[model samples]
Target: MEQAAKELFETVEEYFQTREFKQFFHFVDAAIYLAQQIADVAKEIHLLLNKAVAYYQLGDSEVAVKTIRKLQPFERHMTASQRIRYLNTVAAIYHTLDDTAHYYEYLMQAYALATDMNEEIALLFLEGNLGHYYYEMKEYAKSFMHMERCLMYCERLNFEAHEPYIIGRVQYINTSLELGKMAIAEAQFERLEQFPHILTNHHYVLAKGHYYCICGDKQRAYELLAQVIRHDGQHETILSTLYERFLHVAEEVETLEQYVETLETYYHYLGRLKEAQAKKQIDQMKIYLNTELLEEMLWHDPLTKVKNRRYLDEKMPIWLDEQHSFVGLLLFDADHFKQINDCFGHRVGDEVICLMAERARQFFSSESAVVIRYGGDEFVVFYSVKQLEGIEVMLAQFHAHMQQCAFTVKGEVHHVSISIGATVVRANVPIEVLLEEADRALYQSKQQGRNRYTQFQQHA
Candidate 1:
């Protein structure tokens, strides 16, 4: 199945290179089928990413974003290359929607990751995108720097004849023109034109138009720029800038009738751009809300509304690595929880569990701690000693609070007590070791009394 998946992935890449999105999706489906058969989560995520990019290339930005969101849950499972691809694909989708905030967010994320990996090809995509981003942001100097870096990577990787290199050249030329470096821009433009089939590139045409517009060849600039607008006007950023450039030239050097015609076309594209922007705003809002809700659902326990074991499993390593002070791990278990369920039924037992969770949350609310529902009738409180002064006093206060908390069922009052085992360490340690020590302490608490707290102690 792995070999079959690999072949399917290679075929998908071929289709992607050819821009045959339909065929690309077919291979992706086959790869996903094989991935499911083998429970290959990484391959599945990679295939889904390919699907998202294919949809994006087909101009379905909404579907592309949705597709990427579906992979959020398994993002941690992605290998380094898969993660870079995911980031670049997300940036591309956001770029298509003119979502500057999200576009730059993902673009910079990919750039940082690529820089760390020292992956030249990955940097090729990221640098070109950053060049485009700064270009649209009107940071001409920064845009020029990124485009130059992109071309440098292209030359180093022997990708000078590739689309990314071509686009980088075009953007570099346009950015040069923006910075008033007409001589350099003209020189780069002539050099870029030497490449076979470069004359038909939309971006090349746009750059040429900018050149002519700058040289005061108004008629030539109007013709080339207008051609780009007609062909590539669906790209809002490009269309907006091209229209503005074309209008300046038209108003200056064209006849009154020609200028009026240009104004009418410009207004049409302007209206479309506004409508597109409104739609993008709506889509972005929905994506943001949905992503937030999904993250909450993934991380929180539905019953107790605290972090769940999944959250601990995923976030503990990251938190531990970032911890700079002593750490405390406390494990709590409801005493006689099973007996309560057996006597009063599961419903009342559930209510008792909720009551216990609420008390714990309130007691720890003042401390820098995260309460986690580790398993049935078991909770874990992870805290930092730096933020929490006097941990023993806080634990005593919590015990008092739990003692005072009572639950009533069918006019019968019931008191709930909990046993806690805690361990604190001043040095970095494995979570498994902490858990084992805490569990031993918990056993001590259960031996001494069911309704007490025990701290782990090392005997010499």
Candidate 2:
């Protein structure tokens, strides 16, 4: 019966993973029915929660809210993780309903729970949502603060191209532009350009168009905005803003024909925007659902869930091919990791390794830095910096973070450290030679004393 339950749960998980929302709803229904038959309170709650989330995602907010409210009696029975999920789902429902006060209330509750549970991913999602909320409220400074926090988590989790990070980056840029922070917006634009997928994304294109509009490039802005209208005409809020911008630009057109054409396009977008708003009101009564899943194998490390070695191998060549110079590489290994495994068992050792990876992630939480779990207890970080001083500061942070990490085994606390080697790579240098230099420096650090970093000195 346990095996059957396990298989059933796996099937449900696969349905969710594959983004088969309808199938996921059906599976959850079946699971709930079976769980009720077996009188398994925990399993029943779990399935019901899944059902509520699925309903929420399907645009059945009323049903979802009602379903979740039924779980109030069982709230005390939920695990910490399950409770966090429940709170987050409630926050999402409020957000959908445009109930800003309730959204913030539930989100903050979820944030506190996530922090207490050390659930990094959940905290990141909450931060991103908060950022979006503040951005929409026209509180630029507050939005930037939350978006920056989201960006840090995105970097730490190696989720550079993920939806949350992408959205956060766009929001950050938009707010910066609104605040007349042209330099900051330009810098963010460069980073946004690094992801080719952004060019095709409706929100990204709209943000880029706004940036151009702010920078006094009316023609370019109009072209980009047109692309956005073409692709995302159904997005009422975005189209409403785009329509206003179009009208503003149309008034500034030099030629009569240009003015007339722009005005016609503006009217078209306005019509679409109104139609979309009406459809949205109708959708509130009907069900809407779709799913888009990311392929995790390309970038993720299976064990530590950081960027894998393959991500490093694939990404580095692109930079090298582009002749990106002054790139810094840091290769590090856990100090006395084998000794820990021998003394504390492999389970504890694995935990220590994961801890080290997490520390590396925190240390390298910058857009330019790419942290990879090279293999086993060793990790590699590649970062782009014009000056060696920047690399030194990062290395210092890495050392400090390592010193601060604490691991507990059977009520006994243990400290772990890493030995790191660093080297700066030039465009002309072979990738192998760059890696070897970093590896040599790492060996020197270990030989001198672990928990320190050594820089590879280039021979003239």
Candidate 3:
């Protein structure tokens, strides 16, 4: 029976590799039927998991979730490794469903189990997955941390010949560039030179393009990036990333013609990508709406319509755990907020808070920064800072923008100012300590002057 099951699984795997998804499903169904007939619990669980993966790949996440839930009763029968695989499968389904919170949740669970078992390959895979997740989130520091771990593990396990090790190297190069770690990126690029075939690999090409672009060789960067687009333009995520890189270099280059041409190409690709994604999301939404598992509004702040304290509370620990090299936290307190409420009424105060939230949102890139309405008249902004100068420039821009904002209540002109306390989080610091330090800085800022900003000083 085991031999028969193995043969059937091989056929399913072959169909999957051939991109014959329907045939893959047919084989999986047959395997499940055989397992049921033979009353092989282990075989049945395996086939069911495969079926769930198929559903996830087909973008039927609702069905995938139901299929995975069917394995709950067999949880006690699963080995630790099998349980880890099960958790990862569920995480992948959540990722397909666009449920980032749950995706991270399950991935972390699997990571913990893998760590406890001291499973080198499992740890490497989880680290790589987490690195990609943070990379997509534009949390470059955290992304770099995980990708660095992947490289370390690859070397320790002598997995340099493996495909994932190559991919991990590519990702590390890309993320190191993002974090402005040019030396690290260049070292990784040289390492890739050992693998001649990686020169033509799309990810390697893209990373090299970014490295060159950062090193002030826009022409070479453009050539490599153009090659990537020509070969892998259909991949929306890759195209989007290339488009963003184009936008970044557009400002630094003296010539506009080539940049404009690349922008046009990127715009065309992005339009097609967005259209396809929109349709897919619509279909996903229909499935979600039909099911009883409606998403909750727990993460959003009602008044400002931004992320709430709960969201920040949930995410901050993950960022800290990843040990980002430079995490910047800014605590903003509306200056004289009580006076505004007393003078204009609570409704007007609410309007001011909303406007302030909107301006805060404008000051930071949505992909990299998180703005939370921490409490009444206080907002917290947390973002990964690639350089100290970047944080300074952002602070200056934020201060200037606040000065420009003017509000009118009952035809009376009013100007508002915010006291900001900023701090760079260091490695191994507890989140509570980080917050306390920022709060102390905020108090100092208020004491010095309500309208100014203060950087946290450990001695002061």
lDDT of each: 0.79, 0.77, 0.78
Order by lDDT, highest first:
1, 3, 2
Residue pairs with backbone overlap in model 3: none
Q: Lowest-scoring 10 consecutive residues by lDDT in candidate 2?
A: 286-295
Best by TM-score: 2
Those runs of model 1 whose alpha carbons end farther than 4 Å from true positions after fitting are 1-10, 223-247, 260-460
Off by over 4 Å in 3: 1-6, 13-20, 57-63, 134-145, 156-158, 178-180, 231-238, 247-264, 270-460
Q: What tens digits encode model 1's per-residue C-alpha lDDT throughout 212-239? A: 8678787898777767667666676554
Error (Å) of candidate 2 at residue 380 is 69
Which residue pairs show collisions in model 2?
none
Which run of 10 residues does model 1 get worst, by summed lDDT?
284-293
Q: Could you give candidate 2's per-residue lDDT for residues 224-271 as a string of tens digits?
A: 766666675555556366556656665665478877877786677678
TM-score of every candidate relative to the true structure: 0.53, 0.55, 0.52
For each candidate in turn, give its C-alpha RMSD to the true structure in angstroms.
18.4, 23.8, 27.5
The C-alpha local distance difference test score for the whole of candidate 3 amounts to 0.78
lDDT per residue for candidate 3 within 1-460, as digits (tens), equals 7788778877876876665665665456566655654446777787777777767776788888998998998898887877888999999888887899999999999999999998888889899989989998999999999998998999999999888998999999888888888888888888888986887676777688777867889878866666666776766656466657656765566368866776787778878888878887675555333332222246777567678888888976786677567777888878999999998877578778877888899988987788889999899988877777676777877877866556775578888888888888664667777688889988998899788888886321
Ten contiguous residues with the weakest lDDT in model 3: 287-296
Model 2 TM-score is 0.55
Query: Which residue pairs of candidate 1 clash?
Result: none
Question: For candidate 1, what is the total of clashing residue pairs?
Answer: 0
Best candidate per lDDT, number?
A: 1
